[model samples]
Target: MGKPTGFMEYERSVSHAEKPKERIKHFNEFHQPLSMEERKCQGARCMECGVPFCQSGIIIGGMASGCPINNLIPEWNDSIYRGNMKQALSRLMKTNNFPEFTGRVCPAPCEAACTCSLNGDAVAIKENELTIIEHAYEEGYFKPNPPKVRTGKKIAIIGSGPAGLSAADQLNKRGHSVTVYERSDRLGGLLMYGIPNMKLEKQIIKRRINIMKEEGITFVTKADIGGNYNAEEIMKSYDSVILACGASNPRDIKVPGREAKGIHFAVDYLKATTKDILDRNKTLTPDFKNFTITAKGKKVLVIGGGDTGNDCVGTAIRQGAISVVQLEMMPKLPDQRADNNPWPEWPKVAKTDYGQEEAISLYGEDPRVYQTTVREFIADEQGNVCKAKIVRLESKFNEESKRFMMEEIAGSEYEIEVDMVLIAAGFLGAQSYVADAFGVELDVRTNVKTDAGNYQTNVDNVFVAGDMHRGQSLVVWAIREGREAAKAVDTHIMGYSNL
Candidate 1:
């Protein structure tokens, strides 16, 4: 702790963001970074408790409470407070491979679980972290550090997403020849495509990829293992294979008129939009086509109340959508923490995400409709989605199944005209083509079957991580799994791992 009374002396300070109306004109990051002096004050607020629940990463009441990767929160905060940004970044990188990505996108459970939050506001842990790493970059601290000796073993990673990138970083540091194969035309699977440039700029991802390349890690893009290249050839060539392909298969609505032309998956729509932006900016330099899905002057309807759904809402508003409405089957959560929710636990409260805030600023009302779902889609004469038939639902806990189920109420049906529908319900599991091509066994949920403690699959020389193994999850969890799987793969190759 830099100052024992820091929490008492200084109030919590957070970074300011651009006004919603101004930011809706274009797709760019709007969150302002805190100044160095302000960052120090924020870091000093870390109580650095004896227990330090910020790094505990426990699942209190079955919800995540702290940093999932067990980040050294107090140590880094002190380092920042003491004006030792180099030391602060070193501490931050000890656990997380990509602090820059997490700094911008993570929900910051550490702040929610902070000891100071009981009465006062929590320390600005997320901002402090972002400041440390950005300072490191500005001071020329980040550079390529290649391994001294090579293990002479080759490993194939079957995805270039967060999990695969984390695994590649660790395994390469352990002196193994690691090659990441991506089916997309460019690297950084979701990082390059699924996410908007405004949230995580593609240049940041490219900078890290360039550094990894300089450190002898190879990335081969547009290499589809199950389709273009033979999976058998990969198995015979590499000593071990890590399947880090994320869960890309989107969940679909089975209602009538689902086959309408204007209906699309949230991932597909986001990918296309980002790709167009990248192409127009000449970042990727691909021949641009006139494939347009713009929401300009069109009524937008987003189905599901998750992050992806919110992303769709934000993207539509930015594209100049005339109006937007998001539907959630479950009832709205309480505005504040409920009786069942306690301190140091993730609060289940109604909070405005970035997208909703943008929508409300533009439309003069909150766009979310709680306790509602689309029963069917209405198509125009051209077989394009023009409206949605929605119904309010009542949720109850099923005693036998121990799950919350929703049932549509009688005489609660309504209709809303719309030009586009984005489905963001959730993902079921990873696509089965690659898994089936390798003849790998799958669990009941269709995720790759792996033995506990050993992330290896039933198929010989094949390992799995990320959503392919554990189902859809946070980026932090995927990075952890990737690092652990790399250690396992290194052990399998050299008969032992120093990773």
Candidate 2:
């Protein structure tokens, strides 16, 4: 441990964020980093338990309980406390290939599973990590290290997202020639589009990508293997192919009037908006007429109550939406941790995400409408959605049937006028076209079929990882899969592996 009495001497202090009203006016990061002294104090709060459940990365109740990459949290905390930032960064990079991304976007399960959290407070591992990497960058500690020798083995990675990038980093480090292909014009997949700029800036992603490029990894953007380029042809050329395309197949609401022009998938909407931003910055064009979806002066109703839904809410608020309402199928959670949820576990409680804070500040009330679902959409003559009919639902467990069901409450039907509807119900699985093109088998959930121990697909030379193989999951989990898949590929190629 850094200090025997460090946990008791220093209290937890998290980074401060800008007020919602001020932050929503611009598309930039709102959370400000804590000072050097504050970060050291936060790192000192680490008890460094013998078990260290914060780095366990185990599954409990079908959800991730700690850091999925199993980062060396305690060691790094001690390093930071000793003012050894280079060693701290080295320890962090041992597991997580991209600390900068996770530090900003990850929910920090490590904090929730911390030993200190047993008393309702956790060590600020996330902030400490961000501080270490940012300090390393400023001190000129991070530099590109290309492989000393080439293995003459070529590998192709699809998607260029977190998973693919992680795999490329690992395989290239092992002396393999790695090439990452991305369908979009830019790399970083969801990091480039799905997530908003206010949460994770694009420049941060580009900075890391540049380092990876200097490390002898090739990035080919605007290259769609199953589309303009033949998947079979690419597979034939490369020694191995790793699919990390992610779960791109979005779940859609199949209700009446869904074909209306105003209805759109959340991913499509976010992608279009970010693409416009990038293109406009490149071309110096002032015209935004081609960007079809805009929330300006419109009543926006977001269907779903997850992170993506919150993203829609925040994006709409930034776009100057006249009003916003977020609908959730489940009831609201308690503000405090329930009795059944004990210490050292992620608390099942209600909290305001960034978007809800913005909405509440502007409207004087929270925008989330719990225990409600859309019954039908009412559209105008132009085939555009104008209003939504909703009904309250009551959830109950049927003892006889041994299952839970939702029943619409009587006389609880209500209507709200809305000019736009964003369906943020989340993804189902990976797109079918790529899997079909490669003739890969899929599980019942539509994810690529791979054994638990081995990430290899039915084809000998093909492997799968990330959401494409494991379903929609955390970015850290994707990075883990990518690293492991690279190991499996290296073993297959050289009859020995060092991953």
Candidate 3:
């Protein structure tokens, strides 16, 4: 370690965020990163523990503990403390290909598993990573370095999300010709559309895509493999096919007025807003006529209390929503870790994210209604949603069922006026159309079925990874899956993988 007593001398510090009330007026990212010198002190706070659980990537209590990519945390921290910015960037790129994406949006399982977090605040690992990568970009350390040689093997990836991009990056580095196909108008499937612009700006994605283009990777936008394009022909042309198409089939809530005019899936709502933002930026016109699912001047009701729901709250607020409320069937998590959730496991605690904070600042209370669910939707004569019948729920262990069950509390039903409903209750798995078109079998949960130890499907040369294979998951996991799947495809084509 560069400084043995640095952890004792320094305290954890992170980025400064724009105030909630001010930031809610726009859809831009709110975080302002710390300066280089202050970030170096944060790097010095890494205690360099003997085990260094921050890089373990272990599953404790059925949740991921650390960096799924198994980053070399201590090495990079030491490099940063010694003022070796280039070396730190090199070490960072060794494990994770897209630090810019994960540093901004990842929930930071590494911090939860940090040795310092057992007693005090964890080392600012995520923020330090952001600083290192951004510094490398600013200092021109990142350049378009095409492979010196080509292996003559061509690969096609179905999706252009993090997993697909990571796989393409690794395979390209291994000197293989990689082509990424995206169905959207632009590149970056989920990163560009599913996530709100406030969390990750679209320019960051475009910058990386341009560099990849310079490195000889082909990106085909508006190319739908299963629907518009010929999926079978694509498979025959490429030596191997990796399906990184994310799990995008939203889990919808079935209620009385589900077919109402103003109800939409969360993904549709988010994608439309992002497209509108991008389109308006490109052209001088601020036209939004194409977007059907909007929250303007409406009392919006979001179902589910997850990250997606939070994003909806933020987006609705920006779209001029009159009021917003989120429903969650499960009880709220404790503010602090419980006795059962010990050190090194993901803390089972509450998190007040930027969206929730903004809602509180605007509405004078938190927007989340914990342990409540929508029972029915009331619509007007025009078939437009107008209100939601909500009910309080009690969770109890049912002995016969041998599982926790949600029971509606008696005399707890009530109604609230709402003009729009957005279902953000997470996703089930990949959409059936793509899997069906490829003739690939799916697991019971609707995720692509693959052997436990492999990324290949039952059909030869057809591979699946990321959320499509592992169900709805974090961005870091998607990157890890993409890297692993790229290696699998590389080995399947050639004798073995050098990725």
Tens-place lDDT digits, model 3, residues 176-214: 999999998999989999999999999999999999999
User: Which pairs of residues have clashing backbones in candidate 1?
Assistant: none
lDDT of 1 by residue, 407-488 (tens): 8899999999999999989888878899987888888888889988678999888999898888888887788889899989
Question: What is the clash count for each candidate, in the order shown?
Answer: 0, 0, 0
Error of 2 at 440 (Å): 0.5
Give the winner by lDDT: 2 or 3. Answer: 3
TM-scores of all candidate predictions against the true structure: 0.97, 0.97, 0.98
Candidate 1: how many backbone clashes? 0
In candidate 1, stretches whose alpha carbon ends up further than 4 angstroms from where it belongs are: 282-291, 399-402
Any runs in candidate 3 off by more than 4 Å, and if so which?
282-292
Considering only N, C-alpha and C atoms within 3 Å, which residue pairs clash in candidate 3? Answer: none
Global CA lDDT computed for model 3: 0.91
Window of ten residues with lowest summed lDDT in model 1:
282-291
Alpha carbon lDDT of each predicted model: 0.88, 0.88, 0.91
